[model samples]
Target: MNAPLLEVQQVSRSFGDVRALDGVSLTIAENEFFALLGPSGCGKTTLLRSIAGFEHPDGGAVLLGGSDLLALPPNKRPVNLMFQSYALFPHLSVAANIGYGLKREKLPKAEIAQRVDEVLETVGLTAMAKRRPAQLSGGQRQRVALARAIVKRPRLLLLDEPLSALDRKVRAEMQLELKRLQHEVGITFVVVTHDQEEAMSMADRIAVLAGGRVQQVATPLELYRNPANLFVADFIGTSNLLPGPSAGQHLVVRPEDVRLVAPGAGRLDGTVADTQFQGGTSTVAVDVPGQAKPFLVTEHGATEAVRGTPVGLAWQHEVAVGEGLA
Candidate 1:
């Protein structure tokens, strides 16, 4: 097998009382879009910072292409970090801001300009090259930051909550844009994000972290279908965990998997407590007598379920077994 482009071997970090990263280890392939996903204070950011040389690990080593990345200073490392804020200079034009790093390197002005223009076109910001940060939209500014990072041609690009600054619509747009840019630049992108959907939409592989430990590392579909443990099943998406046939066993079922049937027709029966219309789909909350929480069912298109209506909840038993969850 080819060696991984980036290897984080048993990396750990602590902040006085708290262990921010506890023996976390993972690898990223060349030109891969990777994501470190977790809730706030879950060490995803800490791990990202460690890779970018902002934080030194207390143990283990970080390797980039078989070389020790920890031994190099932040600037000396072949990596660029894009902050959530985009950090574009308000006074500098988009072209100038994108070329700032090259200028600092004392590269010839023509070379810097050529690289800046190429990256601007790559990011679809060539038309806005003359505009200052203040004149650009939030999404445009994010593009500027991305263009600046890629203009340096770093081996690895680290993004800290890259889409958190945009509004919902813009965030959605940028999610696809990010994936496109990663492919276009062919750079290994390691993004740290608390948003599960964002990671699912953008990452080629996702490392779900919790309590300073990596819970699971898999593709979005694999992680969603075959969660390594209960935490992963619960965290990745909405799962209806029900009592299994055996003692002390539970089966994880997705809302979409739960089918509504006639009375006495399925494994469980419940009463519809509420129905939520969500554009293309609807969520029906069913109150099963024995279950502590209401069981949710996702239905395609519009659904009408009057409150207190009796409903039967059924799902394919083999689905759980197929996923190795049973």
Candidate 2:
């Protein structure tokens, strides 16, 4: 196999007393859309900053194209970071904002203008070039920031919470845009996000982080289907984690995998605590006798089960599907 485009080798960092990145290490392939996913305070942002040269790790090294990346400063490194806020200059026009980095690089006036126009067209904002950041919509502002980052044509682009500022609808739209932009430009993207759905929807592969360590690194489906441990199983999506036959292990059954049946028909029986209608799917929370948390069962369209209804839950046997990843 070919070498990775970016390699993070046992990178470690810490705050005054708290360890932020505990020997974290991962790799990214060329032109891959990769995500660092975890909850707040999980060291994902710290790791991204470290890779961008904004933060230095006490130990270990970061390599870009097999060259030492830590030896350079943020500006000197061949990378650009897009802030969560989109960080567009309010006073500058969209065109100026996109070309700001090029100006600093002392590129010729004509070349900067040409490159800025090319990027504006690439991001589909050619018509809004004259508008200021404040005049643009949230999505437009995000595009300007993206255009600015890519205008420099860096080897790797780091985006910190790129779409967190957009509303649900706009965010959904921009997710596809980001993927399209990445593929069109063929630039390696490393995005940091706490949103699981965002990471799952966009990234080719994700590195799930927790308490400064990598839990598992795999494609979204692989991570969902074969979680490395209880944390990964519970974090990626919903998992009905009941005790397995062996001690200290769990039978990780997904809600979609669960089949609802009459009380006497299933391997386990439960009382329907509640049913939540979510557009095309209904999430039925079932309270089983031995389990502390309700077993969530996903039913397509509308569910027939109501509160207080007794139901049985059965899923495909482990042998029929595949053994849970540990």
Q: Put down candidate 1 lDDT per residue, 210-315, tens digits, no spaces.
A: 9999998999999998888777887888988877657756788899988889869988999999999999999999999989899999999988777899989899
Give all TM-scores, in the order shown: 0.96, 0.97
List candidate 1 stretches off by more than 4 Å: 1-3, 245-248, 321-326
lDDT of 1 at 224: 90
True-structure lDDT of candidate 1: 0.91
Q: What is the lDDT of residue 82 in candidate 1?
A: 97
TM-score, model 2 to reference: 0.97
